[model samples]
Target chain A: MAKMNLLQAINSALDLAMAKHDNVYSFGEDTGGFGGVFRATSGLTEKYGKHRNFNTPLVEQGIIGFANGLASQGSYAVAEIQFGDYIFPAFDQIVNETAKFRYRSGNEFNVGGLTIRTPYGGGIAGGHYHSQSPEAYFAHTPGIKIVTPRNPYEAKGLLLSAIFEKNPVLFMEPKRLYRASTGEVPEEEYTIPLGKADVVKEGNDITVLGWGAQMEVTEKAVEKAEEDGVSCEVIDLRTISPWDVETVTQSVLKTGRLVISQEAPITGGFASEIAATVQDKCFLYLESPIARVSGIDVPYPLCHEKEYMADHLKIYEAIKRSMNY
Target chain B: MAKDKKHNTEIVTKPKWFDKDSVTIPMLQILKEDGSFHKDADMPAYDKELIVKIHDTMQFIRILDERMIAAQRQGRISFYLASRGEEAASVASAAALDFGDMIMGQYREQGALAYRGFTVEQFMNQLFSNEKDLGKGRQMPVHYGCADLNFMTISSPLGTQIPQATGYAFGQKMDKTENCTICYFGEGAASEGDFHAALNMASVYKVPVIFFCRNNGYAISTPAQGEQYGGDGIAPRGIGYGMKTIRIDGNDAFAVLKATQEARRLAVEENEPVLIEAMSYRMSGHSTSDDPTGYRTREEEAEWQAKDPLDRLQKWMMNEGWLDKDHVEEHHAEVKAKVLAALKESEKVPVPHIDELINDVYDEPTDMLKEQLDELKDHMRKYPDTYSKTSGRLD
Candidate 1:
């Protein structure tokens, strides 16, 4: 095991995936020479030839379309879309082409080898465009996997799993944790099964579920909740889509309360999806209605993003409200 | 068939293969590295008065970039993007335009804004995100927008401004205004679909607009050569769209001035859209947060430094006897002091008031926005030390 930052773990994961699979090819906008703006694919171009890992024009739709075709032809394609906010341009390509490629072809052809990586969420002072958490938009789309990692350790494992899995995956890396979150990650090859949840801490009173950067917020708020004589179980739902409902339902069965948190708007966020599913599964067991703490339903504010974000304090308030109820 | 912008659209007796080489656009280079021009090359405007102002502004910008980069390192500012090597590309081109014309910039066109009389104090106010800032500290540092100057607010998303520029120019056309619009972007932006859409629409609609492509060698880390595009740099695409296209030496102030002046004439008088590809290099990293040593070599940077746009313009001005060497030295010192003074003042100012958070959501804050704002205010009050205004801390 090696202590690595989130970005380093991600880079190590990409390096291992490319090294193990000869057919693996990584390409995207500004991803060559210098390893992209974030340097996630830094040494890939030099180690693998430019033909395998290279840069594409600054067109999101074109990059994903080309990646879908490449992966369909039996090549393991890993594509990067500079930022998650910029991924909207390629929405139709992802929703219509990448997601439906398998079922539409009736097992004749599929882009199951495709993995699109993009940095997402706020806390970097990225202002309007750079700070959006776009997981909710992709989460609603069927047939594609949406996976996010809580920290460095999870980042390395989940990314590898996404790449090797026989399905198209949208791997959203938390930019806020790219360097801030560090942990002991195995240097050797390993894969964490997708659609599974990791129980960070076990308790009896209440269960708090969050993913990606929101995991930190949940843990911090849980700490505060524990201080207030409340026992809280924390769970990181790594795979957002086709999420690990079994683990979450079991946690809620033991702890009769639930709080879901996310950086996106609460109205239609992935957190809402979790809340809806958990309520149905633990109807009689649940002592109180599940609460969701998320961003306001508006475009992310720049200067007042601190006021706009779904921080630990908000989560703490939700935990208190649920505990009282 | 008649010859248009490109070589004879002649009928071919037999089909033959044609490569990208057949339509190569030669780069227009007028000034040499040492401030002297090529044998027959001359400055475009030849206006001695405007020349002095251009050189002064360039020197001020060069100094401002140097100081602000150091300031960012010292944590005096959040971020900074320098217009270092390509100052002349923005400044000289702006020198050729009328202030009435609109400018839509994709970040890193501070030279254009500086040329349009955006003061150092104004720049620092925006950088520091003080109450004095016109944007109310809403945008990131270097994302300056001045409606008064007709310079549209910068959009961070690449190439989004390309199609917007076309629509803006179309509006100007409908009003029958003599003014046109100029949009600035890098060659990497040319790869976006918006670039193609903008060019096609502008040509078909016959709007007056100038599409300036700063063909800097790198887009953050991606180089322009075989990576960004396989064909020749952005100029060839303009030809494909049936628009007037020219490639110029962005480092040479003279070439930029000449090309822009001519493009402006075409745009304003003939209602023609012109595309100019200025070949230069990003002498610095993409931003203060970036480290260029990772992707680019020291030798490559040294080579571009030798072709520094500011040095070439200063040399030409000195050679023409329009500027004195001693005065240039004192002027540099003066600009350095001026920028440092502005930095000091901007840093001392407080950030925009807390109410600014929910004010601009609409003309009047909606009931929901007001409720959210009240909740945030209550949270901040509950954890005063947790969320500080002076220092943005979530801990």
Candidate 2:
């Protein structure tokens, strides 16, 4: 086991996957010599050679389109978009071509061996163009798997699994936790199956569900709720689509109350899906309505960035309301 | 006007670097519209059997387009996109390529699919979206693909296949194979950003890909002349990207065949990208949904009709003494009958089973998908008369 940050763990995972398979390749802007802007792919080109790890032009559409073609022709491609906010340029390629390749061809063709990685979420003060969390947009798209890991352990396991899975996966890394979050990640080959949520803390007062950077805030809020004598259960939903509804429903059924937290805008956010599902499944045992603590419905602004973001205070307040009701 | 503060330059006489007006790339035409070989142009020596096969495929496609369009008008099929005016560009290009080479087409290359042995029955199954359709009724009519044929499925979005072809060719290059990829698009699709990106990447990586642009005169109702570009058509864009390029007469089968043959040699042998612009006209409406009278006149259509590719190929075949006029007429009648029979037979087949709707979304339907499918089936059971396919059967 090695104590590594999210960036180091991701780099290690890429090295392991490339060393294991000759057809696996990784590429993006500045991913070769510069080791990527965040250095998530640091030292890969030197270790695997340029053919297997290289850089591409600063065009997102071309990068994804090229990955689709490469994956279709029996190669494993790991393409990185510099940031989540910039992924819209490749949205059509992902949603239309990559997601529909298998269904559209009726099993004649599929780009199942492709994985697209991008840094997402706020706390880096990247303004509207850099910090936007667009996971909700892709959660609505079928066929492609969406995963966001909370720490180095989840990062390495989920990424390795995504590379080997027989379907396209959108792996969104919370840029805020790249260096802040550290954990003991096993160096051996490992994989955490997608659509499974981990129960970080067990309690019976209320269940708090979150993922990505919001998990840290939820953890702090759970601690605060414990101090107030309101026991809170915390769950990190690793995968967005095909989410672990069974685990969440089980937790909510036990607690009879739920608080969903996310950094995305409140309206039409992924939290709404969880809340609706929980309400439908655990309605008879509910002590109160599901509460959502999320970012306000506004573009992430440069000034007053904290006001636009969801933090521990807001999560604590929502937990108190759920417990009080 | 304000004068610059820091600069005084002399107007030294220097040779002009480029002139858009004089940089016209001439179109190659070996066989003229009059069915005679151009005296100065060299003829491509294809085997007599291959030539007959190409002509036969073209004849079949011509009949298929006519009957399908009429069917759409009669409301038998929902939609159709005909390859009416550019049959030579599509069929002759496919003829020059090896069967193993990949083909990525932009909708109107039905002739290429026909050339690669996609049968009339397969076409009917896809058109009717029947249970036997390979795509499982996912895509609309004319969006065809076959894994056995090495053809990527057609996408409706313009120019998306351009970069995809370049990347697929890169994969072929990595495999160190003698095969390459041919991407077909229209001149109008060239205006998209992906076109430039694909050409630049193909040139920079020196991948083996043939970017075949069918400059078929219009993008829907927009003509190619004043609105498409400010310079010579898509050929110069290829040259500007530092790749080999050729412009050819799309109505002349001999020119398209020879040009593509040479381009394929450069691509596969030298690991170089090549672009060929085939100048033709869309002899029909943009699609069954369009009407030519809205954007063009009958006289203009008549002018292009004089240069029909099918007529040129037939005249050349007759001149070679390989086919007689009576035999050509009889062949068309037989193909028409076969297509009609296939259409009727395919439409009678049932639509794909409801389970297919959620099956291919992943390797296997997840529990979530199964639940959703069950919910849908339950809803259908309640409102049986709303759906035609499931009205009688609930289980």
Best by TM-score: 1
lDDT for position B370 in model 1: 71
lDDT by candidate, in order shown: 0.89, 0.87
Off by over 4 Å in 2: A1-325, B1-17, B391-395
- Provide the clash count, candidate 1: 0
Candidate 2 local lDDT, B19-71, one digit each (tens): 78666799999999988889999777698888888899999999999999999
Return the lDDT, model 1, position A142.
94
Superposed by TM-score, candidate 2 places the C-alpha of residue B393 at a distance from the truth, in angstroms, of: 5.4
What DockQ values do the models have?
0.65, 0.02
lDDT of 1 by residue, B1-395 (tens): 43444764765567878889989789899998888889987559758888888888888888899999999999877788888888889999999999999999998899899999999999999888887998888778888999999999987889999999999999998998898999999988888889999999999988999999998898887778877889988999999999999999999888999999999999989999999999998888889988988777899999898999987888788878988888899999988988999889988887776667767667888888777767777777777776676334322
Candidate 1 lDDT score at position B7: 61
State the TM-score of the second chain for every model.
0.94, 0.95
